[model samples]
Target: MMTSKNLLELFTQTRSDSEKICQPLQTEDYVVQPIVDVSPPKWHLGHTTWFFEEFLLAPNFPGYQRFHEQYAYVFNSYYESIGKRVVRTDRGNLSRPSVQEVYEYRKHVTKLMQELISKHWNKDWNPVLEIGIHHEKQHQELLLTDIKYILGNNPLQPIYGAVSNEVLIENSEREFIEIKDGIYHIGHNSESFCYDNELPRHRVFLEPYAISSTLVTNGEWLEFMDDGGYSNTLLWHTEGWDWVKKNDIISPMYWFKNENGIWSQYLLSGSQAIDPKAAVTHISYYEAFAYAQWKGLRLPTEFEWEVAQSKINHGNRWEWTESAYLPYPNYQKPDGALGEYNGKFMVNQKVLRGSSIATPANHARLTYRNFFHAPLRWQFTSLRLAKSL
Candidate 1:
């Protein structure tokens, strides 16, 4: 129901915000991919631009010519229907395009998009444009988190900007809020924009349970570590135990102890002592499950999280849920290349509820379903404990 002019404004703002996130990085910082999980900043810039061009302008715009022929293969990410693309691990190796050139490509695509929205506006075009806007917003969060990973892993530990790593500490004492057994309707029900994964709202029956009123804090996580939480095999799943021994895992990502045996974490602002009052972050589902097991509790199922969300204060971190990423009942993927977005990756992934500090403004919704593999810890993820009655 958004006007063309409003959509245009939103599109412009989303594009500008992405560039702003990279302003603090130097030329050298744009190309390094320290891990396979993290994409280079330069690649994020180009891939998002390619998304708009490939899906919108190329097919619909009048006589819209590509900025570069090879750019498609260079920037197309995981779209099998879009022909060959650069391998995921080799994104950082693509130094030919240069940062300046990538910016130029963005400018080219953005200008045409503006014209498309303003001059030849169509009411039917709103859905795809909205998706493009939100898709870029998604990349905006990844931009910050990936940049943090790039700089945090550097030997010099360079500062990116004035971003905060502290969680907004709630004043209330922690307690569990009980929910009675009942059927709850879940998924996006409003007319506003949402990803395809959140569509086709469905009903779920949840058992009586109690969920924590607050997230687990750094102090609590420290207690787990001091009590040998990492070394205890009984606290972890079999595969999680193998991952711990294989990687020599000790603490959450970006955490390190000084020579004096003091714990500190690297933030975008700089390295600082860990704030015990802040919520714990940068943990994987395996670690979250292990921590809950240590405390004789379990993670809430996605249904429970959604139904009890009104009572809990979330959005500080992406809370891990005891649910797998799967389609809703009668869920049908959108036709064509757009279908490739969420339907293809429904296997072997855990669902994460809530948003995080790095999540873009207005992007998180109560029905939004974020998912990642069990061992991946690069994002700002944490957990809240739950128990069955």
Candidate 2:
């Protein structure tokens, strides 16, 4: 249950986290995305503010007035039933609002949300507040990923995060563990706030199968490179092959080669030699699938992945599954706009269970569903090998 004070503190802190990340950017960099894939920093800040206002404020506050009626249209993301929204492709074009104005707007919305939280003051709304905070957290990550994608394209090669990602790991081996098949239930089980797709647990069938004890590391993937993994069409799905060729991709998104043929990958702080112990990241399902096929393996279905996860530390990397993103059995969405959280995304996305380094600690769970389009590789994503024994 949420006391008004606790909910207000959370809202303030989460909003502060977003602002802290934006502190590194120059005002010009905030508006650098010439394409839709990179939302202006200003937009990311205000859009999250818009979420709280739309979902929590207007519904509960008797005298609520929209900060800007134009903002409601400019920021509504894919909620067609909510009426006309700003065109997705043109979001980066709204440079007129200025980054400072967005922060002011954030302050305005935060003030209203604090007032509403106090007035309504119920435990029921606590779940709503919790989910909204995490939703903003998810956006915090996307904001970084998208900004990196945009900056990586710049000729300047600007650095966004100053902290080094240097590390030493005690475990470097990729051990494989086998699980005996049985009926199992998967999805959220009153653990906390969850998306609709992770609801109403269901059963699944499986054979005796083995999954890699750890994520496939940069060392192992390098061997695939040595074996011409990219050239071998037999290792790829038809769609995957096309995507690879179209992008001219020969390695993960962050990889580059020197004139001397030394391979390296960019970390948050700067570029570094690919570590054998670190997970192979920035990979799409196509890449994970093709790599598995090359090694006479396969990606597990969501249930098989979930069942295996119950026994392991949901750490290191998010494992891609063969399952398309969909709703679970007997799933009932939460009422109102919160219902928009997950149930609406059941189609066209692939499920990636487990967690990645970028995922916040304590948020990962066996039933947690992470998803993306099959060909997209802009995330800290990788997979484990699953094989039928």
Top TM-score hit? 1
Candidate 1 displacement at residue 145 in angstroms:
0.4
Model 1 CA deviation exceeding 4 Å by range: none
* Candidate 2 Cα misplacement greater than 4 A, ranges: 1-5, 162-172, 334-336
Structural similarity to truth (TM-score) of each candidate: 0.98, 0.92
lDDT of each: 0.92, 0.77
lDDT, candidate 1, at 267: 84
On lDDT, the leading prediction is: 1
Query: What TM-score would candidate 2 get against the native?
Result: 0.92
Error of 2 at 167 (Å): 6.9
The Cα RMSD in angstroms, rounded to one decimal, for candidate 1 relative to the true structure is 1.0
lDDT tens digits, residues 1-389, model 2?
Answer: 45669668877788888888788888887876656666777788888888888877877777888888888887777767677887878887887677888888899988777777766666667777788787887778777777777776675667777642322242645667898987777777774656667778777778899887667778889999889998899999899999888988799877887556788766567666777776788889989998999888898888887787755555556678999988777888777666777888889889988766556533456677888889887777877788888
* Candidate 2: worst-modelled 10 consecutive residues by lDDT: 163-172
